[model samples]
Target: MNLELVTVLVLALIFVLATARSVNLGVLALVAAFGVGAAAGLSTDEVFAGFPVDLFVALTGLTFLFGFAQRNGTIDLLLRAGLRLVRGRVALAPWIFFALTGALMSVGAIFAIAVVAPLAVPFARRYRIDQLMMGMMVVHGGMAGAFSPLSVYGLFVNSFLAGDDLGGSRLGLFLASFVFNTAIALVVFLTMGGRFLLGRTEDLAGAPASEAEAPGQTSGQASAQTSAQTSAQTSGIDLYQGVTLLGLAVMAVGTAAFGLDIGVLSLSAAAVLALMRPDDARVCLANVSWSTVVLVGGVLTYIAVLEAAGTVEWASGGIAALGVPLVAALLLCYLAGIVSALASSIGTIGVALAIAAPMLESGELGAVGFVAALSISATVVDVSPFSTNGALVLANVDAEHRDDFYRRMLVYAGLVVGLAPLAAWTFSLLPV
Candidate 1:
């Protein structure tokens, strides 16, 4: 095998193993991608060219949009609404968080973590809730969005499988399953996880008057407090108008007006939104997680080289040689999901789908099963100890609530692992 191809395969395995170890697989993958390209004697431009520019743009734009939502009390409003809906039921908090996260993701792909992070601390502190539960909710919420059509995960997966006979590549169909998974998971969290883990009175002590006193005032008080903090430190913008206009504009213009890719539109919107407020530009930029950008930029180069060198092709052939294409594909996805939990979902999904694309295209794996595996495989990174969502929970959790966070993660992971495979198995047994 060529040195470049060997390097790509080795990096991919490292990426998967790193997920189990809770390292930043994206950063590592990014570095490896560049190194392999350089080792192959590819130019800097060529090495970097494979990076997904459009997705990065979308990710940045989504970050800014989330910043806008958090600042203008849009997310606060939603959070307040969630508190009211739950009505002091601690067990229901996880599902409430999950639903809210899903709703935000449905609108903007990458905004869930940014939107949910700050809230997790206060909510956990207020309710004396489990930090892990909060983390699970945040991770799952963002991931649910990532897997949605609005997210780059779906876009990248689709782009790789584009024009192929794979049934799993359909945007609407994939999203339908994504939504169902979230919904089912949300319900399970509320009913199964909620009854046992939630409803502790001590948890609601963070906002004494908020949840227990009048209940209606919970949302109002929380909203007021959040707005004050955000506005005091920074000037307020018309968050509702800004987000609504920007989100709608991007979707409409990208799809209708400019005929541009959603990622491009998303990225452009971020730049445009930043330009809207000169004074807030610093804050907005600061709010954008550039580490993630750097991580993604590097991986783009890596995956591109993987394609150029036929590393993924050869690996697919190796799997075929095992004479268990479906099982191999499913296992690959499982490994991908776990790895994704560490790096973030997009990179894991990017590499996994990249490797599997050839096999799916070759009819080594059935279409329905392929999509099922893709959907299931895309979410493992959501709850990893090093995941962005995991970071949010870890940072937000007080000492008292630490155990709660882990407990919920254990519950969430177990369910996610179990449910995803069930979905894939059902797909495998289907008529197709």
Candidate 2:
């Protein structure tokens, strides 16, 4: 068999092994990268060069920065503030969490899920809200803002399009995702019994305020400080947490307004926080999702080899020969949505864009709209049980009926995978 065919077959095998054996797909992909790189007649150095250094820096920096926030009780502070903003309106509780998480993702996608899912799931359980509703809303909110101009997804799409000399609208993609996710959230709110929460605010605050302390901390300190902190929180934000919130604001505005390098600014802000709270260093560092970092590094490294070997071009060429741009677009959308529902949404988006670029350049379809359809469809299905955001929710639930929640999420996510691509495509067909 030819080199291209061999590498493609290996790709299929990696997915099968990961699914069947519950192994880290990244590890398998890294091994395949070496074998495929060698089979393609590339030198060792060239293979290593395919490593995605920039993405590594981006994911690590954001996770590291947010890790500090998580440990320092800053995220807890935000949750308290959001709950207060809802003012006992349980019906609005999920929306509050949704908007806040969406705003975070507008700044950065990967870090948003890591930070928000932990908080939202617990909140859902506390109020007897549907875990699937709350969890999936958080996922949708993350994807909603994920395509904003300052976000990684938007940056990736824009850069990819620019490289192809295509004129794509950054705002268009953002709007498409925002609208699509909002519609989904609305449906969830109405059908999932959100209306039942109205005027029913008792017992919501009956649960004692719980603190999100760094690992290795004591309940003694938390108990002693809980009343005072709760009182202070009622009137105003805690001093240290307020400062951390300010720092987060700067991270957002600095990157979005001033066009600062997000990775650099995140690391700098986290470093400052770290210096101020040296005792929290170990816990913060421990919380950064190293597995995700490794997954991204490995998967993209393998993808780089595919790019180097002209496999992406070969795929696009075949898609182009189909003679129907819309049909090709739909197929690619379904492919991206299906794979992303199971694996890395970011990876799937990158690969999908590579395949769609040829059809996009043919001018038979609207470049901006098609890109929006591709990206939103690729990410919105992160509600699937197999995806990180979905799994995060399932993990955070109280152990009671955990499997039942998982099954519910599975059913909901399956529905999204089946229907979301069509909605995303319809939204993209609009002029916006």
User: How high is each candidate's TM-score?
Assistant: 0.75, 0.87
Worst 10 residues of 1 by lDDT: 208-217
Q: List the lowest-lDDT window of 10 residues for candidate 2.
A: 206-215
Error of 2 at 227 (Å): 5.4
305-350 per-residue lDDT for model 2 (tens digits):
8877888778888888898777888888899899888877766776
- Position 366, candidate 2: lDDT: 88
Cα displacement (Å) at residue 69, model 2:
1.1
Model 1 lDDT vs. the true structure? Answer: 0.60
CA lDDT of 88 in candidate 1?
A: 64
Across 1-432, the per-residue lDDT of candidate 1 in tens digits comes to 677458766775766666667555566777776777777777778877777677677667766666655555556555655666666667666666677777676655455765575566456555545445456666666656555555545555555555234556445435544564576556645654355664454333234222221222355666566455553424433554456456645674565455566656655665565666655657877877566666666565677777766676876677677787767766776776656555656666667766777767777666655665565556634565456666666665555555676666666666666556545444543334
lDDT value, residue 344 of candidate 2 = 73
